[model samples]
Target chain A: MEALVASAIGLLTAVGIYMMLRLRTFPVILGLTFLSYGVNLFLFTSGRLTVNAAPIIGRTEPYADPLPQALVLTAIVISFGMTAVLMIMAIGGHLEAGHDKVNMSDTDDDTPEVQS
Target chain B: MLTAAWLVDVAASAVTGDAVTVKITHWHGLEAAALWMSLAAIGGGLMALGAYPRLRALWDATPRPEAKAIFDGIIEPLAAACRRLTDGVHNASFSRAVTVAVLAIAGAGVWAFSGGTHLAGDRALLPVTPTVLALWAVMVIAALALPFYHRDRVVALVLTGVVGLLIAPLFALFSAPDLALTQISVEVVTILLMLLALNFLPKATPVESAPGRRFGDVAVAGIAGAGIGWLAYAMMTRQPAFDPISHFHLAQSKPGAGGTNAVNTIIVDFRGYDTFGEIIVLGIAALVIFALSETLLRSPTVTRRLGAIAPVREDGDRHPMMLVVATRFLLPMAMMVGVYIYLRGHNLPGGGFVAGLVFAIAYLMQYMASGYVWSHARQRYDHHALIGWGVLVSVLAGVGAWAFGLPFLTSGFEYVNLWPLEEFELATAAIFDLGVFLCVLGAVLLALASLSRLGLRTGEDVNTRAFDINPDAAQAEEVR
Candidate 1:
């Protein structure tokens, strides 16, 4: 099961990367969303799989790893910030350049490609 | 397993000692187990769906923007008015450097004077507190009065370094060596990055503003830093009552979950969920960086040449062949040490956190020595992919445990005969460690990469800022 979930995450990441390398902005964003999902899933798994147990010992039979859950709550919150920042950047770029092009050299010189 | 103390007492009716009863009878059986399993799956699935990544994105980016906005509005008027008062500092680089130098000196002075800190235990230094207050007062006064008098950039970096370097002592005094090492490394990277950033900004303009206002500003800043610092110092020294977590750690160190390594036990068993969540945060940070890089992060044709940064100091070849060669020599040794630290983390102070940082620093050194061209050429994995892979591996570890009719992140298993070396105990724990390592590595790498790339963009944000700063002036400049 761990292998399955991990493999899924890998597949998502691979897809995300492929999209990330593409020239369009929206697919890149979609790819990022996929990647973040993969990441969160991965971290949640790190506590190692357990069943029928919450982290609160007496709340159930076997206690689950509460720390990972708590950490995940915060992660969810932080990811929202990241998403917003990304969206804002995306919108900002569209506004500036009038096109949602990935690796646009007009504003951000990220591609590092020599300008024509 | 189902019997309580009283029930067991009645059942046996023989022994009468304070034998520890686990109260196993208040038990949740397989049905309850199924419920929790389903719930975790749901939650994990939602995150995987990226249904609400924006929730955290808001929190992390703005840090409670409403409160900040309120504070800023109130402060802005005063700050604007206060700006008229200039600390008579001429050389901006010198002054900034001096500020950093003063802080570094303070760190050194604290160590030199205190001679390795003892747990003060309610011992308050009121007189020296006043001196600290006075120094802070002086800091403000100097900031205000000598606005025109600038010092070296190195001094400013050191001063900034001093502000946070005290954490190293506190970390050491508390016996958290792993944290101490990470903290110090973080500080080094931060200051270096800050210096690198300063390269792109226009040098600080000479202080030619008002004298009375300068005095007022200095006096205010001094009082503020002093008061804040002293208050924090006092609070730390006071030894606050009601430490629930420490008590919890002590109580749980050797019970129910059954792990002797207190930190590991605490993090994985007691609070594994929290660690899980933090790694998720790391994963998110990586995703966000990746996302951000693709769009609003382009640079100009000339700026492409800027990624090959001039080494730390531009004045001379301070990073000589020997140092470069030495870093090359040490790479393998550092990696080995990182592995050692990572492997022994469950039993010792060294763990994924420190080990990850060690490896990262080693990589950074390589980047510094041979430059990004050579270093990046060897990249086998897309940083984005690495981030995702790291997170997935951690989760998959937990999922495996779930499949076994146990709990997530549960540790301490006996070695079963799997070709005679099937230690689920060690393997499961190691997987978690690797997850942490990847998150840390990805996070620091992305942040620094972003910062470095900032220098490469000469006209970055300048287009936006110039347009905003003065539309008329920008339009005039745009014509040229």
Candidate 2:
């Protein structure tokens, strides 16, 4: 199970990096999503895997590590907000630059910066 | 380090009876696993390089007969499936061949890796279960295949949701119900947000990068995947080099914070500072999204582009009356569930984060079903204010502790007798959780609301409420 999880993390990271390195913004956003998943899972595995362990009090079995779970919970919510931001940014970029391509040329000064 | 030791000693003294078992051992199998990962990555990279010439030739072949045939083969069945799905609600059937292919691929990958991972002298602290192992294998395969299976933005977004579903169950199986609840709810909101964002993006991802560049990306990706896999495997299978702080949290939770749920206690009490920072980040992210949406709405370049590619709408399909009526009934029920989850969070699986997402989702459903114009007319509350006020409430919760000569977010509780009931317990943690609940609800809804503005162009009501005609005038108005 541990091997399987590790491989899963690796797979997600690999795919995420590959997609992120793609020229388009959508896949890049996906790649970031994949990376975040890999990171969360990695953090989760830091607390040794346990089956049917107590999460709260008054259970006979030992508890799985709660600290990592708490951290992952925060990470998950934060990532969702960030992903929304990224999606908006992707749409805005496509509209302004006439394409979804990431990594714009600095020499191409046509893109307008958002002023508050 | 000294403080950590002192704290550990304090916790150890507090917990009576059983001695803490500490294992210090060298996990020799990690070296072998690392070797396997490096070898696999390097081999995959080399294979991609070797396959580059043949792949490029196939991609560049005259008339593209093979590629065209493959494309037609996939699209014909897919189009048929889509048409069938549209014809009736009960006619939706997934392709059996695709399902078989997905299973076969995942099975082969898992089987191949499992053989290499059973090296002697290095084993995971917990015994591996077949169920978990199988789920992990399937999840890994799905993650790997996602980029290739869907070039359409909407399909990819849906596929991401599937991937999230796959992970949420794993959290549940690992005995982390709070994490599972949070994961599932966050997944729903993320997918919904993406669906809303999809309206502004091009439908399909065009083939833009050269084959050689693509091969290079695959190579880099393979190395990163392998490296991370090896590190995670090594870390999980071995005893930690340092003392785990989880024991301290487990010991302190009930006695120190009057909460049975250790994870909740950590978030609301022990590590309240981290949660505070996290909520602030969420608020900022939502605010940034709102600002960007406003920028896009105001930009002439974007509006011109939107005019060219935006979907043309037919009558009656814009907002289904049935969905609106259903949402009217469901909204109050969902709000009830959210409140129920928030109130019992300290002792149960549900908490502020999940409850907030629940409430946000409920509100979003109304926007979806009734259209933004109708929904906005009814609600009449600024999402910006919701976010600001939520953060303020939480910050105040933390600062409230300082008034009582306690550290920040030090939750204080007491048991009091109420008429017609047993002793009722009230804790300051509930107030902190309320703050968390509000912030999460506000931030998520604010971000989605901002994105929903882009979708308003398709509504029956054309927005003709522009205050300024000229660019500088609009800019000055925005400043005001």
Task: Please tell me which predicted candidate would have the highest DockQ against the true structure.
Answer: 2
Q: Distance (Å) between predicted and true CA of B13, model 1?
A: 62
**Candidate 1, DockQ score (0 to 1):** 0.03
**Model 1, stretches more than 4 Å misplaced?**
A1-116, B1-152, B162-166, B203-240, B254-261, B286-319, B415-427, B452-480
What's model 2's lDDT at B262? 86
Write model 1 residue lDDT over B126-163, tens digit each, in one string: 23234334434443333222222222334443443553
**Could you tell me the C-alpha RMSD of candidate 1 in Å?**
26.4
DockQ of each: 0.03, 0.32
**Candidate 2 — which residues are off by over 4 angstroms?**
A105-116, B1-130, B312-316, B458-480
Shift of residue B86 alpha carbon in model 1, Å: 29
